[model samples]
Target: MVTNGTYERGDLFDPNCGTRLILDRIGDKWTALAVLRLQHGPLRFTELRDGIGSVAPKVLTQTLRRLERDGLLTREVFAEVPPRVVYDLTPMGRSLIGPLTAVSDWAEEHINAITTAQGQYDAGS
Candidate 1:
């Protein structure tokens, strides 16, 4: 339920909860990178693609479309000789940055340990 624009938190543990869908969206690698790339400001398609490195054009387009559909970002098109489109984060999207940054920090801190564990597990298998 929502009251005056604030949502009553959903039970994420519930099997039928919509929160899991959101979790899936935010948990994607491309989503994370795209959000991080747009943190500074909006960018055109090519600019975002370049900033995100090797993601294929189709993959990035799909990711951006998903983000737009989820209301996490906005896509604007401008009419010109060649046309222009820009992607910018919404307020809700900007809110994700801090949490994502924390997760990123945790990953950076534990990556070596994680890789070591993976190597050990692979060797045992």
Candidate 2:
């Protein structure tokens, strides 16, 4: 439903809704981390890899490609001696920071309780 080029709100509860795919992308651990890492500014491939911890080079490349395809981020290549490339978040991607931050904070706040619950459940099994 488009009214004068503006799309109406999507119904996420609908199985066919594309919003679920967007949700899945944002819910991904790598995606969330990558987005958070770019919150400060752009970073090079190696920098992103190091900042993201244990992500493999191949995996990171794929993730970056997917993010680029989804319009969440941009990858720019510079014509340098060694050919430098940088990744930066787009406006849409920056919008995710607040929501991701909230989720991250909630996880940090409840991790101990979650661990305790998991342990209790395991012991009872």
Candidate 3:
């Protein structure tokens, strides 16, 4: 679906397209958590890790790198005794907060039903 070195209208629906790549990045649980945390304000690496609890340092590093590479967030390093680094969402990433919040709301509303269905399916199995 590339006409002039850009994806056309239906490129997102194509299986062998870049859309899946970007989706895989943002669709990740860790990525979602990181985005949610950064929505409030910029935070240091440790702050992000602590806020998004249970994530390993290495995994969080990978998620942050991917988000930075995708132009969703910016990473700034400060010259200090410990060389502090902070992460903040760019305009594009900020724009995603509304949609992500809607998804979060939907999940919160449906979680009970989803768990019930899962329990039923497990029992039936």
Candidate 4:
């Protein structure tokens, strides 16, 4: 028998399914920035931090680890005295760039509309 908790086919809205898990992983402020940075090929840990701008090192490390664990990025460590660590987007992460860009453009285009709608909502309330 099929379990109710299972996603089966073509069911992405299931709360505990892989799709939801991925959504939870990537739906964060830092994850978006991290993905954007990795879109320009791979970068060392320090470079990622700089590219993202002002994110604390600890937060950046945690974000990268979460993304890596979720298969959106690959973290590589070079064998050396201090060890060089780099992050690169996986195919999954690269696939997100175009979509994210469209989302960004949409937000830019609709800022006025959204603000107006919010104002209307507040006035109605």
Q: Using lDDT, give the best candidate's number.
A: 1
Question: What C-alpha lDDT does candidate 3 achieve relative to the native structure?
Answer: 0.91
- Can you rank all candidates by lDDT, best first? 1, 2, 3, 4
lDDT value, residue 97 of candidate 3 = 93
Candidate 3 Cα errors over 4 Å, as ranges: 3-5
Q: What Cα-based lDDT does every candidate model obtain?
A: 0.93, 0.93, 0.91, 0.85
Alpha-carbon lDDT of model 1: 0.93
Tens-place lDDT per residue, model 1, 5-59, is 7556778897666677789999999999999999999999999999999999999
Compared with the true structure, what per-residue lDDT tens digits does model 2 show for residues 1-125?
Answer: 34686556678797766667788889989999999999999999999999999998999899899999999999999999899999999999999999999999999999999999999999999
Candidate order (TM-score): 3, 2, 1, 4
Clashing pairs in 4: none
lDDT of 4 by residue, 1-97 (tens): 1368664554677654566666666667789888988898999999999988999999999999988887889989899989988789999989988
Clashing pairs in 2: none
Error of 3 at 31 (Å): 0.9
Q: Which residue segments of model 2 deviate by more than 4 Å?
A: 1-8
In model 1, state the lDDT of residue 91. Answer: 99
How accurate locally is residue 31 in candidate 1, as Cα lDDT from 0 to 100? Answer: 98
Greater lDDT among 1 and 3 belongs to: 1
> lDDT (0-100) at residue 107 of candidate 3?
99
RMSD of each: 2.5, 2.1, 1.3, 3.4
